[model samples]
Target chain A: MRLNLRVWRQKNGGSEGAMATYAVDGISPDMSFLEMLDTLNEDLILRGEDPVAFDHDCREGICGACSLVINGDAHGPERTTTCQLHMRSFRDGDTIDVEPWRASAFPVVKDLVVDRSAFDRVIQAGGYITATTGSAPEAHATPVPKADADSAFEHAECIGCGACVAACPNGSAMLFTSAKINHLNVLPQGSPERETRVLDMVAQMDAEGFGGCTLTGECATACPKGIPLPSIAAMNREWLRARRKVKG
Target chain B: MAVSGLIMLGYLVAHVAGNLKVFFGPEEFNAYGHWLRVMGAPVLHHHWALWIVRIVLLAVVVAHAVSAYQLSRRDLKARPTAYVHRRKRASYATRTMRWGGIILGLFIVWHLLDLTTGTLHPGGFEEGKPYQNVVDTFSTWYGNVVYIVAMLALGLHVRHGFWSAAQTLGVGNARRERLLKLLANTLALVLTAGFVSVPVAVMTGVVS
Candidate 1:
């Protein structure tokens, strides 16, 4: 199969980026999207050309490392991660426009590779339990209701792929931030610091230069993990209660 | 945003209830208008409470619009470069928010000019006859067009805004979300119908 890919090419964060086109033929339908990229890189290496630099690790879809906005979508046509997306979704003579996640916080490290360390900073600000380093706690010690546990686990599935940020028109991190906040707040173990946690996390998220959520609902649609849009709302409620409690 | 937003919502509900008085005929509508101006008559002087309500509403409006504009500006700054290949992942109401807000903003100015100040009324602008002024404004084709359009925009705005405020203010959860959504849609539908009915009734010569 023949496919044309117009990918974003940038020398570094400081350099201006532009779209570069490449044509690849004789691709197998079973080849994964990343593998297809590998074939393209092999071809470029043989020609002594600067190969397209992309980021991928543990390409089994769980790592959330593969980031590509294939043909305008965060992960291509399908609602899955880029790693799991197979070449079969494309047809012959298809022109795919590939670009890195576009956001002020997510600057391009190279071609297709971005510095997602901003997410790390947001997580570092809160996205954690202040558990002391020790042996695991008894599961029966802190009993959690099935409903709360399920909701928490659902939100816990966020892979931090930056798709929510990329998918949003305003580049808002509300989904990501809310998912993190709800994941811990709903759990029994996370209740101790719940009030302070949301405040710090939301403050960090804003400090990182992310956009405010205006109930757009785009992030949830583009989310590969199927994180619900209500998570943001839940977090907003949590933030307000926490703010009021603190003020009182 | 959540605070000012709820304030506006409260005003909408009250305004709608008050507007519905027109259905009771001119006498009732005029009485309702007189009641609004003199609600706290002896205690706080005539129209004092009305002026206070106006001041609060004006303050809320400025706060809502300013915060929204600031947030929008930051969003623009966050994405200096637009997406090369954009797709629609959000809902229609979410998509139309910015434009809808602008349309509603313009409509508010027109509404105040036509009714409150009587500057844009097509027919004779009666100074105190709220019911007559409303009928005259709706009698014009352009008046009907503008009012209907603005009301529709308001409906869409409220549909999304109501649900959003619930989430922001922490008034909803997963189980109650569907209920909240239904309420949002219902509020939008009912408000749109209620507000548009006056103009529609006038155009159909039911009110005149």
Candidate 2:
């Protein structure tokens, strides 16, 4: 299949960026989106032109490293990560517009790459269960209810891909922050710091300059892991409960 | 923003119920209007109850607008550069929230001036005669135009705002999502229809 691509090109974080058009021919239908980009890059290298820059690791789609907004939709028209998106999702000779994740919190570092360390800071704020470093404890010692365990596992699917921020019109990180909060907050092991977990994480989220949730559901829609939109409401409940229980 | 919005929603529910009384004829309608001022009469001074409601509503409106302004500024700032290949995302009601809120705010000013204070009433404004005052205002084409447009904006605002408030307050979840959406739609429709009914009645000479 042949395709026309309009890819974002930026020299560095401080420089201006624009979409540069390229035409790639002889693309295979089974080739993943990133693989298709590889073909384009190989052609660029053969011509001694600077190849387009993008983020990708664990091309299997679990690393949360691949970030691209294809044709105005995060991860292209597909709901999966860009690495998992195949060329068959598009028709032959179709033109695709590719751009980096757009959010002030996730500043564009280069062409299709944005600095996502803000997510790391948010996680550092609270996304953990405190316990002394020692041997692994017996599973029976901390019994978790089936329902809570299931809920925790559900939220644990979040890959921290930043697609939620990319898709949200307000560029809110509520979904990602909420996912991490809920992942641990639901388990019996996570009860020790439940109050601080939500309160501190939300404060860190706000401090990161991320916008507030408007419940538009864009984040959930773009989420590759299918983290439901209600995760945000659950987080809000935790935050409010913590605020009431732990007065400052 | 969520708390203030819900407070205003509660006020709107009562406001619409009172507005429906206009169809009962001038005596009944005017009496209801008088009752608003005389509510809690024996226990409280005259118009004191009304003043209290007015004060609370004024405060809610101020809070709502202030937070909305702050949230909008932050939201816009959070995304300094917009995507070049923009596609339609959320529902129309969701997208129009900011502008719809502004319209409703402006409509409140005009509405108070037109009827409450008799400052912008097209015809001769009379105090203690809300029944005729309503009719006089609706008699003008622009009055109906402005009112109906605002009411439409109100419907859209409430449709998104009610569900949004539930989420913000953490009262909404996966199980309650359907029920909350239904309630939001019903509330929006009922409020818009009830308020718009007054102007429709006046224009049709049913209340005049």
Candidate 3:
């Protein structure tokens, strides 16, 4: 299916960017969204034109490397990652707009690629559990409740994609930060630093210049992993509880 | 913002209940107004309790407004660029929160001037006769228009504000989401209807 694309193009982080239009023909209906872009890049290379740049690694959707707000919706109209979105979702001759995530915290590095190291810093703040590395311990030694395990796994699905920030009108990273906090904060193994985990992570999140949560639910809607909106409330509960228990 | 907003929401519940006393006629309504000033009676001096409440509400309003201003500024700064292809996102009430809050703040000034201070009252500003003062204010067309519009804005504000406050306070969850939303909607509908009833009664000569 042939498609008209309006892709955001930027030379580097310091330069300004704008949408550049291109018409690509003979696109296969079965091709993934990234492959469709590959077709465009190939054509551009044949003509010695500068090909569009974007972020993508594990094209399998789990790596969270692919970032694109296709047609105003993060990762396109599909709920899955951009790599998983196929060309069949669009009709022939459709004009699709592609842009990088727009958040001050995640500034555009190049065309359709933004700096996401803010997420790394948030994770560094607190996203780990204490464990002995000398030898493997018996699974029975640290018994995790079924409910806690379920909740942890649910939050563990977050891929750090930054779609939440992209979709949030306030560009808040509350969902992403909350997901990381809850992933470890719920488990028995994560009990030791639970208080510091939430406190430090939230502080780091705020220090990163991310906006506060307004409960808009846009972040959860844009999330590919389906992180529930209530996850944020859970994190807030943890933060408040920690604040009361551990006075500054 | 959440704490201040909840304080204001609680005040609104009591305010609406008091406004509903007007349906009972001038005597009961006037007595209720007098009771507000002398609420604590011998325990606290006359108008002292009212003054306390006024001061607390003033502080809450200032806190709420300051936090809202800061939040809005940060929100705008966070998202510096706009999406070229923008689609409407979130519910209508959710999107209008900022503007709705400003409307309520402005309405509070007018409401106090017209009813509490009687400075903006169309007829002679009479003290100790709140029932008649209320009627006089609602007697005019612009009074009813401004009041009804603000009340509608109030309903929308509370509808989103209550649910949002619940979430912000960490009281919201999947199991309680439905219950919280229902409660928010009920409070919004009840408060709007209660306050609007006063102006409607005056316009229709039901209480005049």
Candidate 4:
């Protein structure tokens, strides 16, 4: 299959960018989207041109590193992340419009590559078990309710893809933050730092210049892992309780 | 309509509670009416204050409308060309919120002018007679009918708006969101019924 690609080209972080067109011929239908791009980059390199730069390490879609907005939808027209998308999804001679994730906090570092370090900063603020680590405790020692454990596991699935932030009109990371908050806050292991966890994570999220959640639910819809919107609501409840506790 | 609409809900509750005093006779009803005028008058008396409140309410209505407008635009931009087949998953009320809000906004402006300013009186109340205005407005069958329908629409608006705003402000859990929805619906039903009954009673000659 032959495809016309309009790929975003930027020299560096500060350079002006534009969509540079290229034609890549003879693509296999079984080739993954990233593999297709890799073929195009190979062609560019052979032609003595700078290869298009995109972020992808483990092309297995679990790393959340392969971030691209294909035809205006985050990750692609399909609900899955970019790495999981295959070339067969597009028809021959199809003009594919590819761009980097657009958000104030996720600035473009190069072509199709965004600096998503803000997410790491937010996670470092609190998304963790802060208790002293020693020998592994017995799993049954805590005896957490089945429901709470289930909910925590559900929230734990978020991969910090930054899609929620890109898709949000306000550029809010509430869904991502809430997932981390609820994941730990629901379990007994995370109880000791519950108040501080919520406070620190939320404060760090805001400090990173992300917008507040408007509850549009676009973040959930765009999320590759389908992280529930209710996670944010749970975070809000926890934040309120924490604030009240601090005040008291 | 957003701010004033909410304010009008508050006003309707107070108004219905005050009108219930009619069962106690003229002195009590009149005193209740007088108390509203006395208290609301100072804040409402100055032309500046009245205009200020109107402006603030207008701002809220505009903000609500503008937000809806931008969302609509993005929805269009997100899908410029229609899909071969599309299925909607949103509830009917959620889907029609933009249209409902537009209709409600237009109705509110007309409502304010008709009742508050006496610009378009559906009821023939002699000038300077607020009590007579209340009675005459409620007495007509058509007038009563419109009021009832408008109140029903207001109820629907509040049913969704209250919880939606809370979600937008990021202040609810699943449990709390459900509770807020129930509270909003209950408040809407109570207030709508309370206001609607007065006109029904007047039109039926149950209260004379």
For candidate 3, write residues A125-202 as lDDT tens digits.
889877767777877888899998999999999999999999999999999999999999999888899999999999
Identify the candidate with maximal TM-score: 2
Per residue, candidate 4 scores C-alpha lDDT tens digits across A128-243 of 89777999988888899999998999888888988887776567788999999999999989998899999999999878777755456778888998887777767887987899
Q: Give me the displacement of residue A167 in model 3, in angstroms.
A: 0.3
DockQ of 2: 0.84
lDDT of 2 by residue, B35-127 (tens): 998899899999999999999999999999999999999999999989988999999999999999999999999999999999999889999
Give residue A220's error in model 2 in angstroms. 0.8
Native A-B contact fraction in model 1? 0.79
Off by over 4 Å in 2: A133-136
| Error of model 3, residue B98, in angstroms | 0.6
Off by over 4 Å in 3: A134-137
Worst lDDT 10-window in candidate 1 chain A: A130-139
Tell me the docking grade of candidate 1. medium
lDDT of 3 by residue, B104-207 (tens): 89999998899888888898988889889989999899999999999999999889889988888889888999999999999999999999999999999999
Model 1's number of clashes is 1
The pairs that clash in candidate 3 are none
Give, for candidate 4 chain B, the lowest lDDT window spanning 10 residues: B78-87
Instruction: Evaluate residue B116 in candidate 4 and report its C-alpha lDDT on the 0 to 100 scale.
Output: 77
True contacts kept of each: 0.79, 0.74, 0.74, 0.15
Better of 3 and 4 by lDDT: 3
* Tens digits of per-residue lDDT for model 2, A84-172: 99999999999999999998999999999999999999999999888876999888888889998899999999999999999999999
Off by over 4 Å in 1: none
Top candidate by lDDT = 2
